[model samples]
Target: MSGIYIHIPFCKQACHYCDFHFSTNLKKKEEMVLALAKEIEMRKSEFQDEIVQTIYFGGGTPSILQIADLRFLIDEVYLNYKVVENPEITVEANPDDLTENRIIELSKNKVNRLSIGIQSFFEDDLKMMNRAHNVEEAKKCLEIATQYFDNISIDLIYGVPEMSNEKWLQDIETALSFDVPHISSYALTVEPKTALHSFIQKGIIPQPDDEVAQEHFHILVDKLSENGFIHYELSNFGKENYFSKNNSSYWLGKKYIGIGPSAHSYDGKNRGWNVSNNSLYIKSIQENKLPIEIEILTKTDRYNEYIMTGLRTIWGVSLERIEQEFGKTYLDYLNQQAAKFIEDHLLFVDDNILRTTKKGKFLSDGIASDLFLLNLE
Candidate 1:
């Protein structure tokens, strides 16, 4: 089954550590929504025979849209695309935008899941991230949202500068108190060109310590595991039957259509991304042309991707699939490259499935990179 990802590229305010494509301007919001709907309609044939199982509204802030705007887009998908009867439609919302009424409205309009950007429950942490919500609003929204939605996920940030281990644990505890099914926690990263990066460069804010972040990650894994949550991915924790279908589809390399500015789409062979500019995206779509760049995946490229994504999830890379699909040469190359890591206890082959050991989980990306085949022609 395929999925659809709609990127809403507008935010109420910019977060300090965010580098995602978005605009603080709302003037083009209406035009952007229309463009998004058109893009969905235009790309219908891309997934003509496939049934859509998930529709994700991710963004600068999807909750910034009015109910009518959201309904319009959802209805557009239903009308033009082949979707399942009960597709998992998720909307990524900020705590500040999820009012009591808003939660109810979203439920009525086919949005079965809510991924709230709580970030942190502490006021100082919120301010440090320049989040739009305060401590009370974060807690209040979850209190209200949990009443209306069962399949809810909240994002939390750990390893902020000056945020002690005690505070991080408190954040985890507060999130657990909500009884939500899923939690997507990430370390506070200092992306280049972001306000946080600038602050660190100017010595106004301290840089994030890798040791501190690693410590927080372990704490998160231990706490979530103790509370009946599965550490399904490096950054995601979910209860049984509560994993994010949309993101899971993506990690499994299922084909998906991404609509709107700066969105990425993939078929089995080609990957494409929309232009990052809002006005340009709208203008191009209005002209019946897609504002996207495309890349055709080579066999080596696909194998590398499989290794990268597979290593990060609970389902580790399959050696049989590798040999079958990528041929014996690629499989041998993988085994050869991974031999050292396996011997070091960073990775292991169990039942022909290559997976990272607990000691290698945090460094899975680096290990996966080391196994990549370069310049395969």
Candidate 2:
């Protein structure tokens, strides 16, 4: 089963730490929405009759769009794709947009899940991040949204400077109190060219400390585990059966198509990405062409991808599968590379499955990078 992802590239305001492709200007709202709907229709044949089991609306805050606009996009999908009978449709939303009327309208559409962006519960943290929503809106919106949607996942940010341990605990406690089904918490990183990067460079804001971030991560694991929330993914916690199907598929290396400016697509062999510029994307589509870039994955690229994604999840990389897919030579190389990590207790190797230890999870990216194999051109 394949998945479809729609990107909405507009936001009310830019978050200081975010580097995702988006525009804060509302001048082209209607044009972008209409173009997005057109893009969906245009890309219908890309998946080629594969049963679409999941559809996701991720963005610059998908909840910012009007209900009618969303309905039009959903209708277009239904008209074009052979979507599954019980497909999981998700929309990424912001706290300020989840009004009672809005929630009611969203429930009426095909959206069965909401990934609310509630980065933090502290007013100062919100202000520091230049988020559009306040602490009260962040707290109240989830409660109101629960009336209409049960498959809700909320986002939280950690590692922000001045985000006290007590405050972080309170944030998690508040989210837990709301009984949200799923939570995606991430550490804040200063990406280059972002406002946060500039602020830190100019000493306008304090930089996040590595030790503090590590401490917060441990705190998150302890509290969520005590509260019966499974740490399914490193950044995601879920209660009951509320894990995100769309995101899970991606991590598992399933095929998916992404539509809209700056969106990405992967087919287990090749990856494609739309042009990041909105006007160029729309104009190209208007002229009957897809303004996108494509890259064909080589053997080593595929193997390294498997190592990176598979090692991070509960499903570890399987030696037998690697030998079967890539060859014994590649498997031998992996075994040789992983020897030191296993010896250091950072990786656990048992029953042909290789997974990161709790300690290794913190340095997963670095470990994965070290394990990457470069293809000689």
Candidate 3:
């Protein structure tokens, strides 16, 4: 089964650490919605033979749209695609946008899941990140949302400058208090061109400490595990059957269609992404032309992706699958490159599946990169 992702590229305000494609000016909200519908129809044939199992609304801020606007987009998907009975429909929402009435409205629209962007529960942390919602809004929204939705996930940030271990633990505890089934936590990274990056460059803010971040990662893994949450992915924890189907489909290299500006699509062999600009995306779709760039994956490219994503999840890379799909040469190369990590106890092969040990989980990306076949053609 395939999945569909809709990227809403507008935000109420910019977060200091965010680098995602978005516009604070929302004059074209209605126009953008129509354009998204048009694009969805235009790309329906891309996945005509596949049943859509998941529909995700991710963005700048999907919750900023009015319920009617959201319904319009959801209806468009139904009109153009053959969806599964009771497909997993999710929308990423900010605490500020999810009022009591809004939560009820979303439930009626077949939105089975809510991925709330409650980055922090502390007022100081919220202000530090320039979050649009306050501490009260964060708690109130969850209290109200829980009454209406059971499949909810909340995001939390760790390793922010000056955020002590105590505060981080408090954040985790606060989230647990909600008793949500899934949690997606990430470390604060200073990406180039983001306000946080500039502030660090100018000494206005201290750079993120890798050692502290590593410490926080361990704390997160341990706390979540103790609470009976499976560390299903490097940055995700979920109870049984509560894992994100949309995201899991992507990680497992399943086919998906991504609609809207800056969205990406993959169909087993090729990957494509739309232009990041809003006006350009709308204009191009209006002209019946897709504003996307596509690339066909080579054997090495696909192998490297399998290595990276597989190492990050609970299901580790399969040595047998490697030999079956990529042949003995690629399998031998993977074995050769993985030997050092295995020797260091960072990675281990159990029952022919190469998985990262707890010690190597946080550094899985780096470890995966080292095993890549850079010069393979």
Best by lDDT: 3
Q: Give the Å shift of residue 283 in candidate 2.
A: 0.4
Q: Rank the candidates by lDDT, best first.
A: 3, 1, 2
| RMSD after CA superposition, every candidate | 0.8, 1.2, 0.7
Looking at candidate 3, the ten consecutive residues that score lowest on lDDT are: 368-377
Structural similarity to truth (TM-score) of each candidate: 0.99, 0.98, 0.99
Clashes of 1: 0
lDDT (Cα, tens digit) per residue for candidate 1, span 116-137: 9999988888999999999999
TM-score of structure candidate 3: 0.99
lDDT of 1: 0.93
Clashes of each: 0, 0, 0
Q: What is the lDDT of residue 249 in candidate 1?
A: 90
The better-scoring model by lDDT among 1 and 2 is 1
lDDT of 3 at 230: 97
Rank by TM-score (best first): 3, 1, 2
Shift of residue 155 alpha carbon in model 3, Å? 0.3
